[model samples]
Target: MGARRMAKGIGEFLMELVGEAVAEVILGLLACALLLSLGLIAYLSWSFSPRLTVAGAGGLSLFLAYGAWGAFRNPSKDRRRRGVAAVATGGFTLAAATAVFLFFYGSDCGCL
Candidate 1:
């Protein structure tokens, strides 16, 4: 019975994570659409820039970090796993974004 409960909890956690990812994607799409409609995104359609991308990633990491803090505050064993995963993911994303920022910044060439 305990094993079954654990499995169900794990499944729920997975689903919740998936839902969060999907929501983020949808939110990004909406933001992009809004920008395009407002003619902001079109101004640089012919160019490629990672500044916006790094900002997005950094923002996502911050969100995940906040979620991790919430998960850690939960008084449940199952949530500990989720908290660890969130911390790892958030740290990884932040590190990657920082690396990209440093590289581009040192290059002294804003966008390719």
Candidate 2:
């Protein structure tokens, strides 16, 4: 009976470790996706008009950077933080996309 209990305890510990590892990988992937999307936003903005308005571009970039940092610092922190960061990053990205679109379609911002 004692040996069985020990085995069960060890199994539970291993399962927890695996869960944490999976979470870490998922968070890392999220970070990479944010950065990649931000890059694409920047490229599209610049492509429209070498000097187009990048109003929220910098903020969006910073948002992604901060998110990555937060994830790296606290991998095991409540999953809520990760979700919040991702949402913030997405918001910034949307802002950047809007700015780029308005720059090309809206009234001339004299970027070009």
- Which candidate ranks first by lDDT, i.e. highest? 2
TM match of model 2 to true structure: 0.49
**Which 10 successive residues of model 2 have the least lDDT summed?**
103-112
List, residue by residue over 8-70, the lDDT tens digit for candidate 2: 999999999999999766655555555567568778878886545365656657776775565
Number of the top candidate by TM-score?
2
Which stretches of candidate 1 lie above 4 Å from their native place? Answer: 40-112
Candidate 1: lDDT of 32? Answer: 49
Name the weakest run of 10 consecutive residues (lDDT summed) in model 1: 103-112
lDDT of each: 0.60, 0.64
Superposed Cα deviation of residue 27, candidate 1 (Å): 0.4
Per-residue alpha-carbon lDDT of candidate 1 for residues 42-100, written as tens digits (9 for 90 to 100): 34532456677567657867776765555446567554446656666566666556556
